[model samples]
Target: MRSCSGWRRFLLCFSLLLIIFHIFSVFEFHPNSVIEIAPKKRNKKSDHLVLGPAAGQGLPNRLQCQGSKALNKSHFLTPSNASNVGDSISFVTVFTIYSTSLDSHADDKSSNLVTVGNVSYTKKERSMAILNVFINFIEVTMPQSNVIILADPESDLSLQRNKVTLYPIQGEYNRDKLMLQRIRSYIAFLNTRLKELAQNPGHTSHYIFTDSDIAVVDDLEHIFQKFPNFHLALTFRNNREQPLNSGFIAVRGTPESILRAKIFLQDVLEVYTLKYTNASRMLGDHLALAWVIKSQPNFDLRRFSKAQAFIEEIDGASVLFLPCATYNWTPPEGAGQFRGMPLDVKVVHFKGSRKRLMLESWNFFSSASDISDMLCLILMSGRTRYDF
Candidate 1:
C-alpha cells in the first residue's frame, strides 16, 4: 500500500509538470528555451523602452514591411557578386570587431571576434557574446540586406552565410597603435566602396558603420530614406562636453557626400595617427571629432529641431544629426533615460556592463516565433505583464 501511494504521487507530479509546460507553450517558445516571467505585472520602470515607432513622431519614412516582399536574390548584393558591373544595392551595414581591446596586453590569448554558431547567453559580460547576439539577431531579421565585418587579423569565424562578407584589419596589436590602425581600416574600407561606386556609377549604396556592442531591435533599412539628401548621418548626445558618438554613422556614396565624409575621416585619421600615442595620450577620438567638426570647410547648421533631426551642410554634403534617444538606445543617456525600449529605437548600444540586459531582451524576443503586438508580450502569463 505504501509503494502504491509512492507511485501515485510520482504520477501526480509528472502530470503537474506537463500541465505547466502546456501553459507556457502558448508563448511559442523554443523547446528547452528558458523563460523567467515575473510573478507581478509588467514593470512600468522597464516598459519605458518600447519596440517599433510611435505615430505622429515625424518619422515619415518608417519600416514598411506589410505588403512588400523581401528583396529578391538579384537585389541582395554580396561581395561574391558585388562587382557585377552596374549592380545596385539598397544599403550595407558594417560591423567592426577585433581581437585587440582598448587595453592590448590581454589579447594574446583572448579574442573578441564572434559569430552566430558560437554565441551563448551565459557569457553576458563577454564582448564576443555581445557581438554574437548582435549578428544572430541581424542574420535572422535583415535577410534583405548585405552585412560585412571589418574583421581583425586573427579571426576564425567561418560562418558560411551569403549575407556576410569579411574584410581584413591587419597589423600589430596595442592600445594606441590599434586605435590608429582601426581609423585607417575604416578609411580604406569606405574608400574601396567609393572606388567601386566610381567604377560602376550604378553601384551605389549607403554604408552604415556600427560598433560591435550595438543590438538591432528592429529593421533598420528605412533609416537612410528617413533623412533624404543626407550624405552623412551622425548620432549625437545632449551633453555638450562630449557631443559626438561615432558608434553609429551613415555615409552616402555621392561624389560630394564622399568628399565631405572623406575630409572628416581623414582629419580623424590624422588626429589618432599623429597625436594620441601610448607615450603621450593627448587627443582621444571623441575630442578629436569635437575639434574636427570645427575645422576648415566648417559644417553650417541648417536645421536643429527636436522633432526632426539637426541638419548640417559642408559644401552640400547634407550631414544629418540624429539624437541618441531614437536611434542608438543606450542606458540613461537619451532613450536610456526612459523606462522601456522606445518604439523609435532601431538599435541598442550595449556598452559598459549593460550586455546582460541585451541578452535578456534577445531571449525574450527570439523565444516567440512571431510577436506582432506588444500586448502579446504583456499578456504573457495569465494576463500578467512581464519586463526584463
Candidate 2:
C-alpha cells in the first residue's frame, strides 16, 4: 500500500510539471484554412520611424490544432521523412563586415569600435566572432552543407574551396536604408543562382537563407526532407502585427519552385522600385514579404483556418510557415536570465540587444574552439543556461 501511494504521488507531481512546461511552447498545430498576409503597406512612416531599435544596430539578421489533442510532447511535429541531405543543400547569408583584427593588432581603423555588453571590441572583430560561431557550427552540425556569403566588395572574407563561396554586392547603397538594400541584394543573388542552375536538370538544390547573426544549432537541412513539397519555408511569430520574419528561409528547389520564387521576388522588388512610396522602409524584408502576399490576386483570407497552420499554398508555390520559437529561436529575455534551450531548437537569431548572446551560446553549444571568441567571452554571461 505504501509503495503504491508513493508511486501515485510521484506520477501526479510529474504530470503537473509536464502540464506547466507544455503551456510555454508546444506543437499541436492545425493552421487556419484561410491564410492571412503581413500588413506593412498600411503603416509606413516617411520619417523611417521603426518599432524597435534601427536596422543597422545588428545589421543582420506554433501550434497545432488546439481543442482536439492539445499540442504536447506526444509525437513532436515531424516534416516528411528522414533521408540523406546528399549534395542538394546550400546555406546562404548576407553578412556585411569590415576587415577584422583582435586584441593588440589594432590600428587606426580599430578605433571605430563596437561593444557587446560592455566588452570593448572592434565592430569587425565582434561581427567575425559572431560569424565564426555560425560558420563553425554549420561545419560541425551540417558537414555536407555549402555556404554562400553576400557582402560589400570592400568587405574581405578570406575563403576556402567548394565549402564556402562569396558573392560581393557591388554598388552604393544608402547607409540609412541598408537593410532594404541588403534584402534586395539577397534576392538578387537567389535570382542569379536560379539562372545558373537552370540547365542542371539532373539535380534540384535546397537553399537555406539566413542572416549572418544567426547560429544554426540543429541539422536544419532536415526541414527540406520533412516538408518536401514546400518551395519556400519561412518562420512566423505569434504576434499578429508582424507575423513573419525572413531570417531563416528554406527553399526546396525545383524548376517550378525556382520560377515561382522569382515571380514572388519580382513583386517584392516592385515595392522598392516604385519611388513614390516608402517601399522597404521601416520593416524591410519582413514588410515586403507580408505586403506582397496580401496584394497577390490569389490571397484569400477565407482559405486559411488552423488545421493547416504550417503549410500554405500561395503565389505559385507552397510556403511552409514554421514557428519562430523553435526554428528562429530568440531569447525572450537577456542572456543573464537565459539558462539554455532544448536541442529541438534548430536556429537562433541574435537580433538587436541580444547580439551579445552569440558568443555565450556558441561556447555552450559548439565544440570547436577559437581563442579569439573565447577572449571576448570574459565579459558576457553571469549564468549560462543549457536546455539539454
Candidate 3:
C-alpha cells in the first residue's frame, strides 16, 4: 500500500508538470510570431506612448501604423525610445518673364500697334508705351515678394530695386517648331539651375517657376507651408488637361527628384525623335511629362494640386491666382467689340492674335480712363478685389 501511494503521488506530480509546460509553450513569445497591437486612443493631455517589440540593437524605430484614426490613437510602436518627430522644413521660389517691345509678339514678329488699358501706340514702344497695360498693372497690384525675372540679357529695363532677379536665356523666335518643345527646353534649363542648388545639402524645400506674364494677386507663402510634400503645383490650362506651360511649377530640390525629371525628359525626347521629324508633332511636352510620371517607377506627378479661383486664402496664408486675364490673361475672340465696357479680368495673357489685338485697343484710351476701365472690369467680375 505504501508503494502504491508513492507511485500515485509521483504520477500526479508528473502530470501537473506536463500541464504547466504545455501552458507555457502556448503563451511563449516568439520573435517571428509577435503580433502588432492596435493603438489605444487617448485625450490630448495623455502622454503619447508608442508600443512595439524591441528590434535589434541600435536600430531606428520602425512601427507601421495605418490611417488618420490610427495616428489619433496617440500610441506609436517604435523599436527604440526615440521621440516622435514633427513636419519637415519647407520653402518656395518664383520666376517671371517680360519684354519692353509689345511689337515683338510672342510669335516672333514685329507689329505696328499695341494697345493697353484703352490706349494705343503706333511707333516703337517703351515700358511706358500702351493700350491694354496689363504687365504694369500686375506689378502695381500683386504682392511685393521674392520675384525673379527671366528675360533678354541685352534688354535695359529698371526693375524694382532688389525686387527682381534678372536671369537671361537665349531667345528662340522659331514658331514653325513645336511651341511645347521650346517651352520644355526653358524648363530643362530651369531644372539644371535647381539641380545645382540640390547638390548643396542646405537647399530650400521647394522651387516655383512662373511666367513673366503672370501676376500674384495675393500671398503664396501659405501654399508652400500647407502642402510641403507636393512635387509640383500649377494653374491647369483650360484647353489642355495635362500639366504644361510651366506657367507655374513647384519643385522640391532633391537629387532623386531632379534625376527622375531628367529621365522623363530623355524618354520624351527619344520617343518624339523616333516618331516625328517635324516640330509640330513634338509639341506634347505636357503629355510626355504626364506619361513619364505615370509610367516610371517611383516618379510621382499626381502630387500636383490646382490653385482655386478667386479665393484669397487656402488653408492659411493668402492664396495667389496666376492672374487669369491681365497677367497671363488671354482674351476670348471678339473681346474688342465690348470697347470701354467692363470686361472681368485680373491677369490678361496675350496668348493668340485676337487677344493681342484686344490689348492693342487699350492703348487708345487716356491714362486715367485706361486705369479706371481696367479696374472696373476686374471688379465687375465679382470674384476679385481691386485694391490696386
Candidate 4:
C-alpha cells in the first residue's frame, strides 16, 4: 500500500512538471514570435482628423473575417496580414524656410536684385508671388485643405493671412559656417514641434518639409488619407550622379520619423564639423538635407522611389506638387526670353540669375488676357459656369 501511494505521488509530480514546461515553450521569447504576439493596439487617443477606418479594427467582410478568425486561433497578428487592420488616417503639415544671403551679386548680373530695386522689394515681390501661387494652387489643387507653414519670425506679416498657419523661428544673421549650424539648429526646433504634436495627440498625423521657394502646383488631397505606413516621400533627380533635392519631403509623424530625423541631424552636424571645420565652405540648406537623407535608411532611392511628377502620389490617396513659379523658377538671363513651356513642370526651381525678370514675366502671364482670360472665358461660355 505504501509503495503504491509513493508511485502515485511520483506520477503526479512528473505530470505537473510537464505542464509547466509546455506553458514555457508556448510563451518562449522567439524573435520571430515577438512580432506575432498580441496585436499592437492602436493609440485611440491619437488625433483622428479624417475618419476612414479605425485602427486595429478589421473590416467586416468575408476575407477579413476569415483572417481575423485565423489571427484569433493563432493568438497573434501576422505582420503580413496586419497592414489592412492598422491605422490609415493621417494629417498634413508644411514647413517652409527662407534664409538670408550676404553676397547678393555673387551669382550673376541679371539675378533678381538688379531688377527688383532693393532686397526688400525683391523679398516682398517674391513673397507675393508665392502667396498668389499658393492661393491658386489650393483653389485648383486642394480646395479644401488645411496646412501649417513654418517660417522665420522676420518673415513678412502679410504672408500670414488666410488659411496658412505660420510658425516662426528666431532669425540669425551669421552667414558663414554658422549658416550650416543654423540649419542643424532648425532640426532641434522641428523636433520640438513634432514632440509637442506628439504630446498633444490632436496634432497632425503627417508632416511635409518644403522649402519656401517651392510651391504646390497640383492637387494633393490623396496624401493625407494614407498614413503611418508610407514612412518617407521625396523627389530625386533623374541624373544618378546628382543626389536627391530635398526641396519637398513628406513623412508620417510616427515615432520612427521623429527619432530618425534627430539622429540624422546629429550625424550631419558631425560630418560638417569634420569636413568644413569653418564657415568658409558655404554649404546651403539643400546640401545639409541631402547629407541627412543620404545617410538615412528610409530616404534612400530604394525605399522612397521618385515619382515622375513633382507631384507625389502617396499610396494612391494623396498628391503633392510644387506650388507656383514664384516659389520655384529660374529667371531668364540677359536677352533670354522666358519661354513658358509646360513640361511636367509642377514646381519651377529658379536656379538662374533672372529672378526679378522672371517675376515680371510671371506677373505678365498671370494677368494676361490669354491664359487666365481664356480660362475665364471658357468657364463663362460653358453651359456649366464655374465660380473662381
Q: Scored by Cα lDDT, where does model 1 land?
A: 0.53
In order, candidate lDDTs are 0.53, 0.58, 0.38, 0.41
At residue 269, give the lDDT of candidate 2.
61
Error of 1 at 210 (Å): 0.0
Off by over 4 Å in 2: 1-87, 98-120, 159-162, 272-282, 296-309, 334-343, 366-388
TM-score of each: 0.60, 0.63, 0.44, 0.47
lDDT of 2 by residue, 64-164 (tens): 21222212222222223323546468888877654432443554574565543345556556666677767876775576777888777876665555588
Q: Write the per-residue lDDT of candidate 1 for residues 1-388, one digit (tens) a residue.
A: 9999999999999999999998788556654443354322233323123333222222333222221111111122223332332212333333333433433344444343222223421222244455566676665545455667776667555545666677765654344455455556677777776777677875566677776667654565555556667878877665554566777777775766766787777877676556545422223665666556655365542332242577776444577887776666565422222233344555667664444455545665566533223212221211111122
RMSD list, candidates in order:
15.6, 18.9, 27.1, 26.5
Candidate number of the best TM-score: 2
lDDT of 3 at 335: 14
Error of 3 at 177 (Å): 4.5
lDDT of 3 by residue, 328-367 (tens): 3433322122222112223343332233222332432223
- Judged by lDDT against the true structure, how good is candidate 2? 0.58
- TM-score, prediction 4: 0.47
Put down candidate 4 lDDT per residue, 260-290, tens digits, no spaces.
Answer: 5555556656666665555333544445445
Q: Which sequence of candidate numbers ranks them by TM-score, best first?
A: 2, 1, 4, 3
Which ten residues in a row are the worst by lDDT in model 4? 379-388
Q: Distance from true position, residue 208, model 4, in Å?
A: 2.2
